[model samples]
Target: MVETKLLMIDDEESFLATMEKRLSFRDIVVNSSSSGPEGLKILDENPDMDVVLLDVKMPEMDGIEVLRRIKAAHPLVEVIMLT
Candidate 1:
């Protein structure tokens, strides 16, 4: 059995790193980006990604905007915004 692949977007590097490590230990494939645009890029680049854990606050594009874009591009993928 394989764990789900989760893409996490957060401006806080520490949180992302820690979550990635913990999930990785549980056999999840986790990729991370620090901003919305980069997460969009991740969606474009990794279309098969199973889910996204996005932070609500960010520098450039922000979480809602990123979510809008993500939904527009890949509506079937799951997204959970962490505020």
Candidate 2:
């Protein structure tokens, strides 16, 4: 089976860390960011990411804007917004 590579972007540091750990246990490769710009940078560096789990309400940049940018830059990468 192929492992799922996921990028999780949220301003909550503890949530990111906890989810990363839990998801990693489920055979998912998890990368994380605390802000939109950082998430974008991660996407830039890791183009092969399968999915992005993004928070809807975030500081610096919101999920909708991030989703737009992600779609513009990497349309193939799937994204899910979390409230």
Candidate 3:
């Protein structure tokens, strides 16, 4: 079975850390960011990422805009938006 490589983007630091740990334990490789720009940077640096877990509300950039950018850059990557 192939491992799932995920990028989680959220403004909540504690949430990112907690989710990373829990998901890692389940054999999911999670890379996290505290903002949309940071998440985009991670995606650029790590093109192999399979999925993106994005928070719906953020300070600088919202999830929808981020999703647009992600789809524009890496259309194959799947995204799940969280509120």
Per-candidate total of colliding backbone pairs: 0, 0, 0
TM-score on alpha carbons, each prediction = 0.95, 0.95, 0.95
Residue pairs whose backbone atoms clash in candidate 3 = none
lDDT of 1 by residue, 1-83 (tens): 86788999999999998998788778689999998998899889999999999999898888999999999999999999899
Greater-TM-score candidate between 2 and 3: 2
Residue 73 displacement (Å), model 1: 0.3
Question: Relative to the unseen true structure, what is the C-alpha lDDT of residue 74 in candidate 2, on a scale of 0 to 100?
Answer: 100
Residue pairs that clash (backbone atoms under 3 angstroms), model 1: none
Stretches of candidate 1 exceeding 4 Å from the true structure: none
Residue lDDT tens for model 3, 1-83:
78989999999999999898788778688999999999999999999999999999999999999999999999999999999
